[model samples]
Target: MIITVAHQKGGTGKSTIATNLAVELKTSLLDLDKQHSSIIFNYKRAHAGLEPLDCYSIAESQCRFDGQRPVPEAKLDEFLDLFKGDPKTDLVIDVGGFDSPLNRKALFFGDYLLTPCAPSGTEIYGLQMFEEILQEAEDIAGIHLLTHVLINNADKRSQKRIAEMQAYVKGKPEHFELCQSVIGQRISFKTAYETGQSVVELHEGARTAKLARAYLHSADEMTALCAEIRHALGKGV
Candidate 1:
């Protein structure tokens, strides 16, 4: 399965969520957002050292994507050629935004597109606009919505934020679903990125350590949800 984490908006934690999920799964991972590299997470996993585990093991490729816009049909054909050539691998592309040509290319590749949003209403409205664009593209292209919107950077302790997230999700079920886990604002995540380490690998005694554990829990739940979604969509093997 190719799950592309994308949104038309920035700072929504798309790379963070997608990168961590790939590490958690230990399968072949692909970072599609070229301009903003996410090799930091992959570097962390490598520094953490390899285990005797079979999962999203990424291939030898540049973390930066250099595909042309609209993913020219030939590009899609070439990708499909390579994609189908390796049926055992699962792919995850971290697109900068939902409106990018990379995302349009992903749709043609029969991949699932997921977008993350914050608690802000403007961001929420941006997501709606993003969905509108996607739907418009979908009218001409054949694609599937594995799962649409995922709430990121949420503060569960805030009754107001929780209510806002819930309300936004409820209002956009046709194009979104609320993730069960909430990722609180944690500085550890940003700090770990500099050293290319999972927040779990950083100083486990500080506030960052606490955030790392929380992130792990969220990733676990998300991984399971992804599996269930595949089954529900009849895309599982």
Candidate 2:
């Protein structure tokens, strides 16, 4: 399956969600973001003496936006074709936060599209604009599209705001649906990303008792999030 994580606005924790999901689910990662965030994370993982993930970087000099399709349609098709109907493997794609040919193409091709949105004014408004982008992609692909919206990086302050987000998402049920799993804001997420580790793995390497407890909580949250996503995809319970 081609699981794409995309949004039109940046800093919604896309890389965090993508890398952790790929690691936790044991899937390959395809980084289409111009910043090459996942690629760098994998590099750090390798240097840290951990088993490196099957992450591919298709950005920077290797990618060009001059054409209608970035990296060629056949090239992407060949890669996606390998994963289609293959229950054993999944390709998690992290696309950049912008309206471009590459992002639109990913939307069109993804078997399951995910958009991570933080519960904030800007992000909520941005989702409205992104809905327009999704429509445009569907127009090109000649099919209706729906994306799973994940409320990521949430905290106590945002907990009350989830109802607002839910109402908006429910109002547009045909466009997107909110995931039942909500990922909270935690320091472990940042520290693990910097060191190229998933929260699930980071908890094992914690140094202090307090830190260990925090990391363990983060790991539990991540596990729940991954479980919910997998269940949605009918992978497993």
Candidate 3:
């Protein structure tokens, strides 16, 4: 499976979701984003003498683009060609925020496209625009795109707002479906990422009891969410 986490909007936790999912799925990560956040996180994991993410392989394609210049089509093709040779191994791609031919190609190649959005009016508007992009891609490619929208970095206290977001998504069934699992804003996520660890791998001893419990909870939630995504894609758990 080729899973692509993409959005034209930034600060939607794309790296967070892509990294954790890659670790959990034991898949190869193809970092197509210029920021190289995922690659850097893996480097930290290695430098800390941490056990490498089990069965994880990584590749990066760094592209520099000016506002006027289009991303090279050949470059996008080269990165995607990496997956064509290995159909059995799953691949996760982390794309940068910015609409480009490169991103569109990735979207077309994806088995599953995930767009993460925070709970806010502006982010919601971004989601709408992203859905339109997805539609355009599907129309051009003549394929039924399997795209999902996930709520990331939500506050635990904002159940009402979360519900509103869910309702809004439900109203647009043709565009994308809301993910059942929501990722909350928590310090553990940041700490774990800094150490090149997934929430499930975070050591609890260094944290207060309450925070430790929260980390574990997030781990469980992420595990379930990963399973849910796999199942939705008709893959075995």
TM-score of each: 0.70, 0.91, 0.85
Q: Each candidate: what lDDT?
A: 0.58, 0.81, 0.76
12-110, model 2: which lDDT tens digit per residue?
A: 889899999889999988888877788778878888888888876543436432111233444776777777657787988898877788678778777
For residues 19-122, write the lDDT of model 1, one tens digit per residue: 65555545455555544446545554456563312222123222332221223334555654455425455666676653765556665564456677777788
Cα RMSDs, all models: 5.8, 3.9, 5.0
**lDDT (C-alpha) at residue 164 in model 3:** 82
Q: Which residue pairs clash within candidate 1?
A: 7-98, 8-98, 26-55, 26-56, 27-55, 27-56, 27-57, 28-56, 28-57
Least accurate stretch of 10 residues (summed lDDT) in model 3?
62-71
Kindly indicate the candidate among 1 and 3 with the higher lDDT.
3
Q: Order the candidates by TM-score, highest first — what do you get?
A: 2, 3, 1
**Cand. 3 Cα-lDDT:** 0.76
Better of 1 and 2 by TM-score: 2
Candidate 2 structure lDDT: 0.81
| Cα lDDT, model 3, residue 135 | 87
Instruction: Let me know the TM-score candidate 3 reaches against the reference structure.
Output: 0.85
| TM-score between candidate 1 and the true structure | 0.70
